[model samples]
Target: MPFTLYMLALAVFAQGTSEFMLSGLIPDIAADLQVSIPAAGALTSAFAAGMVVGAPLMALLSRRWPRRRALLVFLIVFLLVHVVGAVTTDFGVLLATRVVAALANAGFLAVALATAAAMAAPGATGRATSVLLGGTTLACIVGVPAGAVLGQEWGWRSAFWAVAAVSVPAVIAIMASVPGGPAGAGARGAGGELRALRRPRLLVALLLGALVNGATFCTFTYLAPLVTGVTGFGAAGVPVVLALFGLGSFVGVTAGGRLADRRPRPLLAVGGAALLVGWVVFALTAGNAAATVVLVLVQGTLSFAVGSTLIAQVLYAAVEAPTLGGGFATAALNVGAAAGPWWGGVALAAGFGYRAPLWVSALLVAVALAVGGAAEGVRVRRRAAGGAGEAPAPAR
Candidate 1:
C-alpha cells in the first residue's frame, strides 16, 4: 500500500462522511428548518439525484485532464460545497448546496477510484478500490455515529460543519500525495475508451449494477421502520440496531475485497444470492425481533460487501475504457440509490405490509442474478465462437 493511497483514502473518508451524515441528522434538520421529516429526507434524495446527473457530466468534461488534477479539483469543490451547506439558511439554499456537494462527491469518487488503481501494483486493483471504498463503509461505522452524537449535542449545522472541517486535512493530503500527469494516455486514450464502452457486454454489466443496487436500497431505505414497527423494537433501540448494520457493512466491504481478488465471478454470484437470502429472512422474520436483528445485519452486509467485486466486474467488462467505464458504473449506482427509496416509499403508500419491501427486493435480486447469468453466458458464447473462427482460419 502506497502512502498516497492512504491520502486518497482520507479524501474518500471526508466525502463519504458528508454524504451519509445527513441520514443521522435529518430529524435535527427537519426541526431546525421547520419542515416535515419527509421534506428533510428530500435533501438526501437531492444529493443522490445530483450525483447521478453530475458523475458522467464531470467525467466527460475531465476526460482530458490528468487524474490527479481531477481528483484535487473535485475535492476542493466538495469542500466548498460543504462550507456552503453548513451556513445556508433557507431550505432551498441548503438543497442547492447538497446538490453541488453531491456533484463534487460523485466526481471525486469516480476519479479517486481510478487514481487508486493507477497507483496500485499490477493485479491489486480490486484491493486498491476496496481500500478507497472502505472509507465509505468506515463513514457509516464511525462518521455517522459521531455525527449523530454531535448533532444531538450541538445541532444539525454542527454535523455539516464537522464534515467540512474534516475535509481540510483531506485536501491538504491529496495535494501533497497525488501526482499530476497528462490524461487519456493511461492504458488507452479517450477515443479508445469511448469505443470500448460501445460493447454490448459492458452495457449488460451496467444494467446488472443498476438492478442490484436499486433493489438492495429499496429494502434498505425502510429498514429503521421495519425494525421498530414490525420487529417490535422501541425507537431508542433502532439507532443501536442501525449501528450494528453499519458495522456489518464495514466488515463486509473489507472481506469482500479479499474474496473478490481470489475469485471475482463466483464471489459476485454468492453476493447476489446472499442478498436474496437476506430479503427472504427479513420478510419471514419481521415479527421476530431476534431473527429480524440477525437478518438486518446480513442485509447490510450483503448490500455493501459486493461493492468491490461489482466495481472489478465493471472494469473488467470494460477494460478497454477503465476510467469512463468505472465512472458510469458509479453513476448507475447513484441512480439506483435515488430511485430505490422512491420505489420503497411507493410500496409503503400502497399499504403493503412492512415486510413487502423485502419481498420486492428479493424479487429484484433474483432478476439481477438472472441478468448477470445472461451476461456471463454471452461472454462465454462469444469466446467460443471466436475460437471456432480462429480454428478454421488456421486450417485454411
Candidate 2:
C-alpha cells in the first residue's frame, strides 16, 4: 500500500475509535450528563443519523473538487468537530459536535475510498480499496480499546481529546503524501453523476450492505445485556469478551482483503454463511460464558470479513461516481445502524428472550445471502454480454 493510503487509514482509525468508544463510555456519559442510559445512547444514534445525511450531501456538494483537497478539508472538519466534542459539557452541544464529527468522518472515508481506486494500478483496485477500509478493522482492535481505557481512567472528554490529537499527524501525512491533480479522468461530476443512482446493480449492493449491517448491529447493540443476563456474569467480564470480538474482527478484515483480491465471490458467500452460523451459535450458547465468547469472536469476524467486498461491489456498480457510491454505502450502513437497534429494542420490549435479536440477525443474513446470489447471477450475465474491454463486475 502507498504511504498516502496509510495516512488515510490513520485518519479513519481515529474516527472509528471516536465512534465505537462511545459504547464503552455510555454509563459515564449518562452519569455526568444526568441522563438515562438509553438517552445517553441517543448520542451515538445522533451520530449515525448525521452520517446518513452527511455522506450524500458532502458527496454531491464536493463532487467536482480534487480528491486530495476534499480529503484535507474534511479531515480539518473532523479535527474541529472532535475539539468541540471534547470541550463541551452541555448535552445539546456535545450532540451537535457528534453530528459534525459524523459528517466529516463519513465524508472523508467516502472520498478516501474513491482516491484509493484512482491511485491503484488497473488490476489492483480491490487491494487498494481494502487498504483504506482496513483502518476500521484496525481501529476496532487497537483504537477503540485504548480509547475505552482512556475514558475509563481520565474521563470521556480525555478520550475525545486523544482522537483529536491524532488528526494533526494525519493532516501532516495527508498533505505531504497525497498528490494533487485534476478530478479523476473517468469519474463524472454533479448533475451528470446523479443518474448513476438509477443502476440496479448499485441499488443491490447498497441493500446488501444495509441488510448485513442491520443484522450485525441487531445482535451487537444488545450484546452486553445478553452476556450478563444469559451467562449471569457481572459487568467486569463484558469488556474482555468484547475485546475478543474486536480481535476476531481484525483478523477477518485482514483475511478478507486477501480473499477479495483473489476470489471475491467465494469470500462473500462464505462470509454470509458464516454470519448465519455465527448467529445461530450465539443464540444457542447465550447461557455459556465460554461458548458465548467463542461465538462473539466468530460473529465479529464474519460481520467484518465481507466489508471490503461489499464496498467494492458498490463502487464497481457506480463507476461513474465512485465517491458517491462509497458515500451511499456509508449511508446504507448508518440506516441499518439506526434500524438494528430500534428493532432489537422492540424485541426486548415485547418480552422476547434476550437471544431473540440474534435469531433475527440470522434471518437477516440469510436474506442477504439470497440477495447476493441474485446479484451475482446478474453480474455473470452482464459480463457474458459485455465486450472483452468492459470493466469487470464489482465484488459483493
Candidate 3:
C-alpha cells in the first residue's frame, strides 16, 4: 500500500518493457544491422540468459549494500545501456548492451521484491508482490505495443531511445522515495541465506513455481502462431487477442494477490487444475475461432492467478533468505521463461502442429500439481510429528 511500492513497480515497468519490446523491434533491427532476423532475435535470448544468471549473482553481490543504493545503481546502469544500445551502429555493441541491461534489470527486480515485501505489513506480502507484478503486466499491455508503433513510425533505435527516456522518471522516483537501509537489516549474512536452498520444502516449492511458469510461457510464446494459423484469426487480429490476454493477466494478478496469503494451497490446486483443463480445451478447440478467443482470456487469467501465487509462495518459502529470496523468485521465473520458448521452438521444428504447445503446457502444469501434492504430503507428516515445520513454509 506504500507509495514507495508503486515507485518500485514503476521501476519494473521500465525493465519489463525492455524485455518484451525486443520482440517487436527484431525485424527492424535485423534489416538495419544487415543481419538475419534470427540473429537479431538473439538479442532477446541474451537478455533472458542475462536475467537468468544475473538475478541471484547480483542479489548476492549487493546483499550487503543499502537497498536504495542497489536499486538506483541498477536503474542507472539500465538507462545507460539503453542509450548505448540506441546509438550503437554495430550489432555486437547492441548485443552487449542487451546483456548488460538485463543484468541491471535482474538486480533491480531482485532488490525491489525484497524491498516491497519488507515494506509491507504481515499478511500483505502477497498484495505487495502483486502490486509490483501488476506493473510488469501493464508493460505487456501498453509498453510493448507502443514500442512496436514507435519502431514502425520512426526507427527501432527510436524505440530504444523511448525505453531510456521512460526510465528517467522511474530512476528519479526510486532515488527520491526509496530509503537507504539494506533489506532485512541485521539478518544472518549471506551464508544463512545460501542455507535456505537446502530445505526440501523450499526446493519443492521452487520447482513447482518453475513448472507453472514454464507452462504459462510455453503457451504464451506460441500464442501468435496458434491464434493465426489454427484459429484463422488473421495477422491483423493478433494484437487484439494478445491485448485481451494481457488484460486478463492484470485481472488475475489483482485477484490472486488478495487471496494468495490467505490459503495458497487450495488456490494453487484449484487454479492449476483449471489452467491445465483450459490448455487441453484450447488445444481441442483451436479450429473454432470463437472458442479460441474465449480460451485466450480464460487461459491467461488462470495461468497468472496460479503463477502469481507461486511467486509469493517462493518468496515466503525462502524467508530466511530475504534479499536472496527475491533473487530466487526472479531467477526461477526467468529459467522457465528461457526454457519455455526454447522447448516450444523445438516442438514446432519437430513438426508438432501449432496446437502442440497447448498440450506441452498441460503436461508442465500437471507435473507442477503432482509435485506440489507430494510436497504437501511430506509437509503433513512433518507437522504431525511436531510443529517444527510451520515457520516459513506454513500453509503454502
In model 2, how large is the Cα lDDT of residue 120? 76
Per-residue accuracy of model 2 over 83-189 as CA lDDT, tens digit each = 88888778888888888889988888878878887787765667777777677777777888888889989998888889989878889987887867633336776
TM-scores for all candidates: the values are 0.92, 0.92, 0.97
lDDT of 1: 0.75
Give Cα-based local distance difference scores for all models: 0.75, 0.79, 0.85
- Show where candidate 2 strays beyond 4 Å: 33-39, 182-185, 377-396
* RMSD, every candidate, angstroms: 4.0, 2.7, 1.5
Model 3 per-residue lDDT at 331 = 92
Error of 2 at 213 (Å): 1.3
Give the runs in model 1 whose Cα sits over 4 Å from its true position.
34-38, 187-191, 387-396
Pairs that collide in candidate 3 are none
| Per-residue accuracy of model 3 over 1-396 as CA lDDT, tens digit each | 999898778778878889999888898899999999999989998999999999999999888899889999999999999999999999999999999999999999988988887888898888898999998888888989999999999999998888889888878888888889986565577888888766776677668778887888898888899889999988998998888888888888889899888987788888888998998899899989899889988888888788888888777777777778788789988998888777777889899999988888888888888887777776677889985663223353
lDDT string, candidate 1, 127-169, tens digits: 7877888888788778888998899898888888888788788
Error of 1 at 261 (Å): 2.5
Better of 1 and 3 by TM-score: 3
What candidate 3 gets wrong by more than 4 Å, as runs, is 390-396
